[model samples]
Target: MDQTTAIIDLDLPGPRISRHVYGHFAEHLGRCIYGGFFVGEDSDVPNERGIRTDVVEALRALSIPNLRWPGGCFADDYHWRDGIGPRDQRPRMVNSHWGDVVEDNSFGTHEFMDLCELLGTDAYISGNVGSGSVAEMSEWIEYLTRADDSPMADLRRRNGRDEPWKVPFFGIGNEAWGCGGNLRVEQFASLARQYSTYVRNHAGNEVYRIAAGASDADLHWTEVLMQSFDALDRAEEADAPAGPFQAVSLHYYTMTGPWADKGSATEFSEDEWYLALERAGYMDQLLTRHGQVMDRYDPHRRVGLVVDEWGTWWNVEPGTNPGFLYQQNTLRDALVASVHLDAFHRHAERVVMANIAQTVNVLQAMLLTDPESGALVRTPSYHVFEMNTGHHDADSLDVHLQGVPTRTGEKSELPLVSASASTRGGTALVSLTNLDAQAGRTVVLDLRGRDVVGHSARVLSAPGLATHNTPEAPDAVAPVTLDAVRPHDRGLEVTLPAHSYVTVSLTLA
Candidate 1:
């Protein structure tokens, strides 16, 4: 591949990238909650109320903005009462969604909220809407956010906490058209309006309620949901105001093949590797199409599109529970993260927040959990997040790339050089990713209105897509400080390697 050119105008600005765009998702699937994050105090792992202390510190290091919890499909079956109160008294139940494994109900609402406080991240709770009554869902909200003298509030007090925990974002259900209830699109929309009505927004917590949108290219489902939003918004004119719907959420997962055989996480051919990248690049298209639908109803773009569930979904690691969805992360996963995140940065106006599926010890997790010895190792995906921290809350700058090649027809066309820029104060970050797995390209980064007096660069690249991190070899695929970065007269010239992601910071004079 020939060297490319990327031009950036530092003064050009776009919407502020929400910190929540870098949010994470932690579900009850497999060991994601049980052993992955919550290791009882008796174990060798450091813990506070069964939450692993090391994991907490790791998350804090990333300054993770928000965390969604309890379920993918498990949320629909989650009984809030069963998980509250004393751990010993909390009833056990079968997971029913992930595996037929027993759920000891040890980690509940209080523990989850406490974990959120420990990591200093906001909580995004998913309520049960499938096979559960409306009052059941409403009462759970009261237990978490209501400080009033209601019965639910009293129950929360008796359970232990005097003050209510804040819930900034809430999802009414997981996948209402599938595991959530298997209802039709219109039926889910009708049910979403009814269920969302009872979700209370108490003091100190406005509750950014997110309605579940369609899967991948299911534009009809989003249209139906928006139609419901229109009706709800119009009710205010009639003096019968309805609840607020701040955002609509869509879920997409990158799959190299069919669900039954989603190729190996650690071992795959170059074709499959490119296929994974191709699947990932489709996130941009999905957001663009979904954003267009949202604009039809929300022309002013008031409502946000939250990609609450995303990341590569692959076959479980061999010998693990098939339903657990546990997989390893490689340099390939890191590239996928950069690709999706760059998309979010470009569409900062419509795409507000996105939570990568399973923050730890599940599919595309940041940390791989060794259940036997209670050891944790950071995955390549974690390094991607750490490198991208500069994008949080920064104003986007206009970036243009030319002479870029493309990989056509796997799922979508992927450019060889993907880039995004953001500015904060006197500091500006220029990030670029080279999608070519076998060829390197030198990028002529053209800059205007900014002088790169000093700079630093961090890059994540590996020998091949099969390279990954394990407990024995944690640093096998970590970021290295690149010394090739230097400031030039025609802008900052940089060269990106095959299948690499680099972020350069320009400290203005």
Candidate 2:
């Protein structure tokens, strides 16, 4: 076993790791919407007003803070009106982006809000800018949030909901550099400023407007957005229509292979494992670099950085529609999630929110639903989320590592371990991941500034990298109570298995 030591100074707590950092994304692609999260009320699957009941029950365990809706690329094409009135009379449109299948507009604005309520999560609406107008985007907000007797509110009443819903986060556009219109940074920044002007706050519901930002390593996009923001005269615009955008978004996905031939999700060699970890670890550099540019414009870190889209994107499973982006989740994917989330926790001050690429039946998904049998399977990534729930809304405690092992990949190097720590009222949660595929790790917790009285841990591991859960054996990669944790003179000592993730709950004295 490899040995390492990490120290956490409870007196030196950093920023509050926003629960929003643990958010999820659900787009109108593949089984994600139609068969994964929603099956019609008439279907055999148990549902609440067409929203999947079993799926909600499972996700609720994670205390899901927020959910991003409408699109990734689909948001720019979605027209909220088409989904409102009557479902049977709704227009049918080609998804175009995902599988070229017809979107019956069955799961529209109302259904989405219903899903959020069922999951007890905040709503994050990504508006259309590629193919939509400012008036359309403005009125959609009014229709969902204006509680008074207005044209849009009255239309909403006629559509059945008398009271408006709450929309907390709003995205101006999604990926304008690509599917969201293929626009230049200057053009999108100007559009973001203009369109965001009309996304009004209604009935005291304040929407955190997030402008579409760069993909991987595009620091120029961040520069342009901050430059545009620097031009705004906030002092004079104190109570402006829709206050200046509160945040800018970034999208980064970890892929083991190149885009044209992204490798398999479950089938991979040992070398591929270290490559994925190295790629995932690159998010730290992306956050730090972009944050430096933003700091030059806004030194106080007032504006937030939202990683609205991120996860591992792999090739579609065999016989699956390529456009749908359906892939299997395994131990490797779970570790990828841990790496990204640990990065998010470390940069909590600047990264205000993050949404994994998807929540169900899509890339790096949490749950997979069987279209034919209506069976629900929880992915290993789901267990990671559930296990890390203790970190939500908790103050981040920096972990100082010493003598950590490293593995060199084909193009990059990766530390064999990744970790983050946080504390709530009287308890502290230490999350650790061992990236080595064939070596166990003995980690010593050098607790400082706080006395640890008791500790218990659970480990999420599998016999191999490809271990995953199917409906036949749902607990294939589930967490088990770790029996190797013991109390040391300074704090706790944990024995982590190879290619495993562990969370230790400590009772602070």
Candidate 3:
């Protein structure tokens, strides 16, 4: 293949983007809680408030912006009252949907809020509306955000926390059309209104309430919600909130081949890996389709798109409990994350917040915990987030690439190279990943339109597509500094190794 180079226009029209989209989810399923975040206060692992201190410190290091807690399905079954006050008094219930494990309610509201405080990220709380009432949802908001000498505030003070933590983001429910309730769009929309009506934000608190949104690329659901919002606007007049909904939620997972025929996490053919990349590339279409529907009603883009659930969901690692949802993060997952991040960056105008399916022990976790020793190993996905943090809150620049297809398959073909550039603090950072496994690509970046000086690159690659970091070999996929490249009068050319992810930070003159 001939070395292909493209001149990309550096000037873009979009406004500066927000970094909240780079959030994470922490569900109560499997080891995600018991062994992942909470390892028992009495255990050998050092802990505070029953949360693993080491885990808290590590997540803080990543600068996680927000954490969606209590569940996907687990949120629907959760009862807030059971988790507060005394540990011994907390009620135990069966997690009917997730492996039928018994939930002790030990790590409830207090634990979640404390974890968020430790990580320095905002909390995106998903309320329980499937089996709960509107009053219950209202009380949850009151319990978390209400201040002064109220019943809930007194309860919070009695429980050890003296002040109300600022809860900025709140979801009406989780996958309301699925595990959340199996309700139709009309039913869910009404339910959303009923639940959101009572979620009062105390004085000086501005809460972002998001409605349960479409599953995948279901345009009908989006239509129903949009129509409902319009109807509500006329009925309620000026009494309603700023907008019926602050954001609409969407969820999608990338799986190679068929869902049932998903390729293994640690073992996969080159064809299978390429297929996974193709599936990941679908994010661009998903967001664009949803954006088209949203633009019809929210033409001014008043509402944001929150992809609260997203990431790769492959088969579990061998020998581990299938219920644990454990999987290895290979170069494939890293590339998938990069592609998704690039897509999110491209749609930064509409996409405001996103949380990877989970933070630990679940699908596409960033950190994996060792139940035996309380050790946490960073995954390839974690490093991907760490390296791309510079793009957070940065102005995304327009980037165009002229390249061959990375892989051609029956259903899809991905570009040989994917890239996203952003300018922040007078520095131009470009994140690029080569999905091809056979050869490297020399990309000539056009910087003539923008001012940039010298350049430095950090690259992460493995011996092969199947190479992964195991518990025993944790640093196998770490990033290494590549040779320095001098910025030319017109542009800069950097060689991207095959099946590798590279991030270049240029000092703008």
**Judged by TM-score, which candidate is best?**
2
The estimated TM-scores of all candidates read 0.96, 0.97, 0.95
Off by over 4 Å in 3: 6-13, 231-242, 484-486
- Model 3 pairs whose backbones collide: none
Superposed by TM-score, candidate 1 places the C-alpha of residue 100 at a distance from the truth, in angstroms, of: 0.7
Residue 500 of model 3 has an lDDT of 90
Give the alpha carbon lDDT tens digit for every residue of 229-301 in model 3.
Answer: 6533343353444455577899999988577756698888888888888888898999999999878776667
lDDT of 2 at 40: 89
TM value for model 2: 0.97
The order by descending TM-score is 2, 1, 3
Per-residue C-alpha lDDT of model 1 across residues 37-153, encoded as one tens digit per residue: 897778778788778988998888889999998877999988888999888899999998898889988989999999999999999998888868889988988889988888988
How badly does each model clash, as a count of residue pairs? 0, 1, 0
Supply the global lDDT for candidate 3.
0.83
Off by over 4 Å in 2: 230-243
Error of 3 at 92 (Å): 0.3
Best by lDDT: 2
Q: 127-199 in candidate 2: lDDT tens per residue? A: 9999999999999999999999999999999999998999999999999999999999999999999899899
